[model samples]
Target: MRLLQVVESAATGVGRHVMDLSGGLLERGDEVVLAYADWRMDRMFAEGLARLEPKGLKAIKLPFSREIGPEDLRSIRALRDLIRTHGPFDAVHGHSSKGGAVARVAARTVPRRLYTPHAYITMAPTIGVRKFRLYRALERYLARLGTGTVCVSHHEKAHAVGTLGIPAPTVHVVHNGVAGPARGDRESIRAELGVQEGDVAFGFVGRLWTQKNPLLAVDAFARLRAVHPEARLLMVGTGDLEDAIRARGVPGVELLGERNGPQTMHAFDAFVLPSDYEGFPYVTLEAMATGVPVISTETGAIGEAVRDGVDGFLVPPGDATALSGAMARLMADPALRARMGASARERAGSFTIDGMVEKIRTLYAG
Candidate 1:
C-alpha cells in the first residue's frame, strides 16, 4: 500500500516513531512519503530521514508550526497539493496534533485518514481549564474527519474517549515499539561519563522540558544519594530546562547533552524518566530493550510497559520520596537489578516494531 505520513516536530519520540514507522513500511514493500515540519526539524531526524531516503522513503517538508496559528491554512494547502501531485495514496496517517489537523482536513477525500496523538495537549496536569476545553473541542471535531485515532497507550485512549469525548470504536491503542539498542561499549561509555565502578548509574534520556520533569529526576537522585551516596545520574538530553537543571549544582550528575539515547543506554545501570505525562515513551522501551530496568512515574501507559515491581518500578508523579525509594531499592540490590533487567529485556520483546507496523497495516486495511 502507498502511504503518506505527516508529522510536526520531527524530534524526540515522535521523530523516532515516524522514522521507524516509515522505514518499516518501506521495508515491507510499501511506498511511503513523509511530510514533516521543517520548521521544527532536529538534526537527528534530518539525518535519519536522509538514511531512509536511500531505502525508498520519500520525505517532504511542510510549514507546520508548533502552535495553532495562522500558518495552519498554508500547511493544509500544502498537504492538499502534495496529495494531488503524489496522486491517491492508500492511506494518509498523521502524527501529533498540528500534523493530524492539517492532514485530516487535506485528506478528506482519501479512503483512509488516520491519526496518532502521541499524547494529547489536554493530558498536561497543569493545563488551564479554558485551554483544555478549547483543545478538547477541537480534538472532538477533528477526530471525526479521520477513520481511526491510534493511541500509543491505553491511558491516552481513555483520555480520548472519556475526557475528549471521541468515540470508543474510533480510538485504538498500539503501544510504541523498538528494535532494541545497538550494542555499545559499556565500559568505555561509563568511563567517558565518569561513572566509576561500584556506582549505580541512573540515566535520564529526554528533552529537559517541563513535561519530562528533569528537575524531579534530579531531586529524586539527590534523595537517593543520602542513603546510597555512590549513586550517579547521567543525563543524556538538552532542552529548555538545561540551565535550570545546571543551576542546582548537584554533585555526581553528569549533563551529557543530546547524545544517541539508545547507544548511551550501555552506560546506565537503570533508566529514569519522571515525566509528568507521556503516551508511551520510546526511550522507556529502548531502555527495557537494553536490559536496563526503568524507574518512571505512574502516568500515561507506563503501567502497561513497566510492570511495577516485576520489570521496573513506578511511582506517582512528582513524588520524590517514592521515586527515591524505588531507585534505592534497585541500587542496593545487584541481584534484584539483574532479575528485573532480565524481565525488562524479556518484556521488551512484546513491543517489536514489526508488531506495531502490522497492527497499523491492519488498521489501514480495515
Candidate 2:
C-alpha cells in the first residue's frame, strides 16, 4: 500500500508523528511519502527529513503556509497536481490545519483521504473567537468530503463532534504512541546534568510557548523551591517565550533548549506538562515510557495517558498552585515517585509505535 502523509512544517509533534508513522509503514512493507511545508525559520523539519531518508521514506517540500492566502490556493493546486501524478494512493493522511485542508481538497480528485488534526486549528489558544468559529465551520464542511478523520484522544474526538459538530461515525480516536527508552544509565545522565545523587529533578519537554504555559511552570517551581530547594526544573525545547521564561528568574530552573533524541528523556528525573491544552502530547507518553513520573494538567487527552495518583498526577488546567503542590509532593517522597514511575512505565507499554502503525494499516485496508 502507498500512503501519502501531509503536514505543515515538519516540527514538533506533528512532524515527529509523520516521521514515526512513515518509518513504521516502511518496516511493514508499505510505501510512505511525507509532504511538508517549507520550514525556513527552523530547520527542525529538515533535520527530521534527513533522519527519515535513511529509513527509505521520501520527504517532499511544498510551498505552503499556515496562514491562508493566495499562496495556500497555489499550494492546493500543487497538491492536486501531485495527487494526479503520484496518487491513487491507498490513503492520504493529513496532519495539522493547513495540511488537512489542502489534503482533503486535493484528495477529492482521488479516492481515499484521511485527516488527523494533531490539534485542531479552531482549538488553538492564539486564534480569536470569530476566526475559531469560522475554522470550526470549515472543518465540519471538510469532514463530509473526507473518507475518515482520526482524533489523537477521546477528548479531542468529543471536541470535534460535540463542540465542532462533526459527525461521530466518521471520527476515530487513535492515541499517539512512543518508542520505549533504551534503558540509558540514569546515574550517568543525572551526573552529566550536574545533579547530585539525592537531588530531585523536575523536567518539562515542550516549546516555551504561551499555549504550553511555561510561565505557570516557572511560578509553580518557584513555589516548590520554598519547600524543596534541591528540586531542579529542567525545561527542554526553545520557543519565542524563552527569554520571558528566563526573565522570571525562578531559582533552581535550568532551561536546556531543544535536546534531541533519547538524551532529552534521560535528563529528566520526573516529567511535568503544564500546557493550557494539548491534542495527545507525545512527550508525556515518552516520559512515561522512560519511567519518569509525570505531573500534568488535565488537558486534551492527557487524562487518558495518566490515571491520577496511579501512573501520574493530573491538576486542573492553568492552576499554578495545584501544579506546585503536586510537584512538591512528588519531590518530597521518593517512594511515591518511584511507584508512580513504575506504573507509568507499565502503562506506556500499551501505546507502542507498532500498535499505532497496525491500527493505521487496518484503517487504510478496511
User: Considering every candidate listed, which one attains the maximal TM-score?
Assistant: 1
Worst 10 residues of 1 by lDDT: 220-229
Give the poorly placed runs of model 1, Cα more than 4 Å off: none
Question: Candidate 2 regions off by >4 Å?
Answer: 40-44
Per-prediction TM-score: 0.96, 0.94
Model 2 scores a C-alpha lDDT of 0.84
List, residue by residue over 1-366, the lDDT tens digit for candidate 1.
989999997987888888988888988999999999887777879888889999999888888877788889999999999999986899999999888999999999889999998899999888999999999999999998999999998999999999999999999999889887778999998887877889989999988999899999998888787777799999988889999888988878889997788999988899999998877888888999999999999988899999999999999999989998899899989999999999999999999999999899888877
lDDT of all predictions = 0.90, 0.84
Residue 288 alpha-carbon offset, candidate 1, angstroms = 0.6
In terms of TM-score, how similar is model 2 to the real structure? Answer: 0.94
Cα error, residue 164 of model 2, in Å, equals: 1.4
